[model samples]
Target: MEKEKVVLAYSGGLDTSVILKWLENTYQYEVIAVCINVGQEEDFDAIQQKALSTGAIKSYVLDVTEEFITDYIYPTLKAGAVYEDDYLLGTSFARPLMAKKLVEIAENEGAVAIAHGATGKGNDQVRFEASVKALNPYIKLIAPWRIWDLKSREDCIEYALKNDIPIPVTKKDIYSRDNNIWHISHEGGNLEDPWNQHDDSIYKLSVSPENAPDTPAYVEIQFETGIPVAVDGVKYSPIELLTVLNEVAGAHGVGIIDIVENRLVGMKSRGVYETPGGTLLFEAHKTLEKLTLDRATMSFKKSVSEKYAQLVYDGLWFTPLKEALDQFVDSTQQCVTGAVKLKLFKGSCSAVASTSPYSLYSEDFATFGEDDVYNQQDAEGFINLFALPLTIRALMNHNKDQKNKTDKKVI
Candidate 1:
């Protein structure tokens, strides 16, 4: 009899490394580690080496950074989806692409299951499994944290030590993190305490706002159909655009957020995220939309954006609602082409100026000076009709009060 082969999502991190060994040792399954690069910093060759050394029968490292931005990141950006009004949905969107790749690999290798090292308590477990299930209903999921004896990161570290496996973090310097092209998230350690003012050491992508250069930096971004195409007057590929913006914005401490968000798994978790380029892109996209999108359309899109964010956050990216919302968002983006100038200074990005061919703003019509087309009296009829319901309601109340007084006098 032969054991089944499993495709494991590997990162060369403590959790996945331990899980790779554990799957082989405990279940007798031939583990194949699949490392998909969505622009996180790591040597792919080293990750493959670690996977093979940790008892993986084979290791794969695929670079999917550009695909991640164009497919996952751009759609979310067009929808204007931001989880809880702050998180850039970097991890949220990344998981779906990773899961899609995992499914692809599993199908290719005829693997029995796809495994991940996401903890039972966190959102990643839901995100990974949800996306996997959505893409391939038949593929089984192997979540080690939910089933294994290793209950915590500390436990995993101890297990690694016992197994003589090389792990990245020790118990003293332990903080679970996820990184990608869009953003980097840090959880656990001092971040566990909500009141613990975020330590500067936890940040990797950005300097502290206080430590940022005293001088402000200005950046101009160009967009087409709500998608960022260039930064600082330079055209770039999707990867290059974000990469440049990340470096430029990070230096000025532009995008750092610390929040306690409600996880999909019914628990709250505190995380510190740095999303420099993403922040700049979002600001420019939104400001451009304001210049071009009609007032009614923008207002309705704001309401839809919340739901879109929730769907993405809850790992429902492959669902019908999200697809439909994407369609509507795409329709609205037709006019969202423009360039926006932003000032990045000490953790803030402010839209300084914007111009678009589709701009709805008409200075000629809005100007206070005497103009041929202007008729101030036109607003009187519009206001009267708009206030008609309120006026009728007040009159009705007045009549009711008069009737009550007459009845009282007769009594």
Candidate 2:
């Protein structure tokens, strides 16, 4: 009898590499490893070779960078979703796309199931499983982290050593990390302690603020429908735009954050993230929205943005509520077409200037100097009506006090 085939979301990392071997050894399943490249700086040829050498029957490396930017990154960008006002949802956004690709490979190869190395305690498990369920409901999921007895990274390394499985990580350098075009996040090891500051060497995408140039750098970003299209007046594709911005902004030490966040699985985890290009893009997009979006729309969108961020962070990306919220977010972006100039200094990005053709700001109505459109006396009527309820309440209180005083005298 032939063994059942399983497509595994392989990243060439310690956990995934171990899981790949374990699946083959234990279940007698032919594992097909699929690696999805979403702009992470990696050698695909080496990764593919490693997968095959580690016992995968076949291996694939799919370049999903363009699709990731256009489909996943842009939609989240338009929604202005930032998890906990700090994380850009980089890992959260990438998981769904990765799972989608895994499903595709499983269908192509007639695989009976798909597998991932996502831990049972983290959000990636939810993201991967939700996406797989949404895309291919019939495909069974094998989550090794939840089922395997290898409880810690130490155990994983020991298992790998025993199996002669080559992994990029060791017990000493056991910081579990996820990297992509948007950002890079570091967790595990010393990061597990909230009191310990993140080591400066852990950051790959951004420079330390202390080591940044004393002088500031100014850059302009142009957007159409909340998507960043240009940097410093040079138009580029979504990926190119991010690439250029990352180079410019990373040099100046623009984006770095350390936070202790609430995991979706009812635990707290400390992580450090570097999101250089994304930080600049988000700041510029917000400035443009300030110019183009009306006051009421902006106010309401603020509330909507919080929920959107939560949904994305919580691994609810494929749900109906997220889709419905995207529709509302898209409607708001129609007028969010503009340019914003920003000054990057140290670790901060400040909006220096912004303008939009659809801007509701009127120079004539807002001018400090005299204008024919304004009548100073007209404010009296407007004020009276606006204060009617307050005035009536005050009068009622005064009358009650007078009646009480008179009744006291009579008594």
Candidate 3:
């Protein structure tokens, strides 16, 4: 009989490397490692070799950068989904796409089971499993953190050393990190203590605000239907645009966020995120929307954005509700074409100026000097009609209060 085949979502990182080896030795199963690249810095050939050397039957590396941006990142960006009004859903949104690829590879390899490195406590576990369940429910899912006796990262490290597994993290400098083109997140070190400030040495994406350049940098972003198409009049591919923006913004120390967020697993976890390019893009997009979108649409979209952010954070990306929300978001983006100039200073990305062909703002009507539209005399009747219900309610309440006082005096 052929050995039971399992496909592992390998990251070429410490946790996944150990999981890849452990699955093979523990269960006597054939493991095929699949590493999907989403623009994180890595040696792809080396990752493949590492997995194969660690007793994997085979390994595959897929470049999903374009698809990741167009399918997942852009839609989420258009929806303006920011979890807890801070996180840009960096890791939260990345998991579903990763899991989708895992399911696809498992089907291709004729694998009976799929394994992941996400721990039981983190949101990635839910995101990965939920995505698999939505895509292919028949495949058996193996989560080592839930079943294995490895209590912590330290325990995993010891196990790796015992089995001669080469891992990256060391005891002295141990920080759980996840990086991609869009953002880099740091956790599980000094971040565990909310009181401790983020160390300058740990930040790889951006400089510290204090050490940033004195002069501000400015860039003009061009958007079409809410998607950023150019920067400073230069048309760039999705990857190139983000890459250039990351360089420009990171140098200025923009997009650094440290927060203690409520995890999906009913616990709070502290995390530090650096999303330089994404921050600049979001700021530009938001500024353009303010100029183009109507007051009612903007107000309604705010509520939708909150719900969308929570759903994405909670790993409900593949569900129907998210799809429906995406349709509404797409509709709203129709008029969000514009150009926005942003001034990037130390730790800040502020909109300098914005202009949209579909802009609803009327300078003539808004001017203090003179306006052809919007009659000033119409305000009196409009105010009275709008306030009628409030006026009536107050008068009736006063009359009732007077009656109550007279009744008390009589008694």
Candidate maximizing TM-score: 1
| Candidate 3 C-alpha lDDT tens digits along 63-123 | 9988888888999999998999999988888889999999998999899999999888899
Candidate 1 vs 3: which has more TM-score: 1
C-alpha RMSD for every candidate = 1.4, 1.7, 1.8
Clashing pairs in 2: none
Candidate 1: list runs displaced more than 4 Å. 168-172
Model 2 residue 196 CA deviation in Å: 1.8
lDDT of each: 0.91, 0.90, 0.92
- Structure candidate 3, residue pairs in collision: none
Model 1 residue 311 lDDT score = 94
Cα lDDT of candidate 3 equals 0.92
Best-fitting candidate, scored by lDDT: 3
What's model 3's lDDT at 239? 97
| lDDT score for candidate 2 against the true structure | 0.90
Model 3 lowest lDDT segment of ten? 166-175
> lDDT per residue, candidate 1, 287-309, as tens digits?
99888988899999998999999
Model 3 bad stretches (over 4 Å): 161-164, 167-172, 401-411
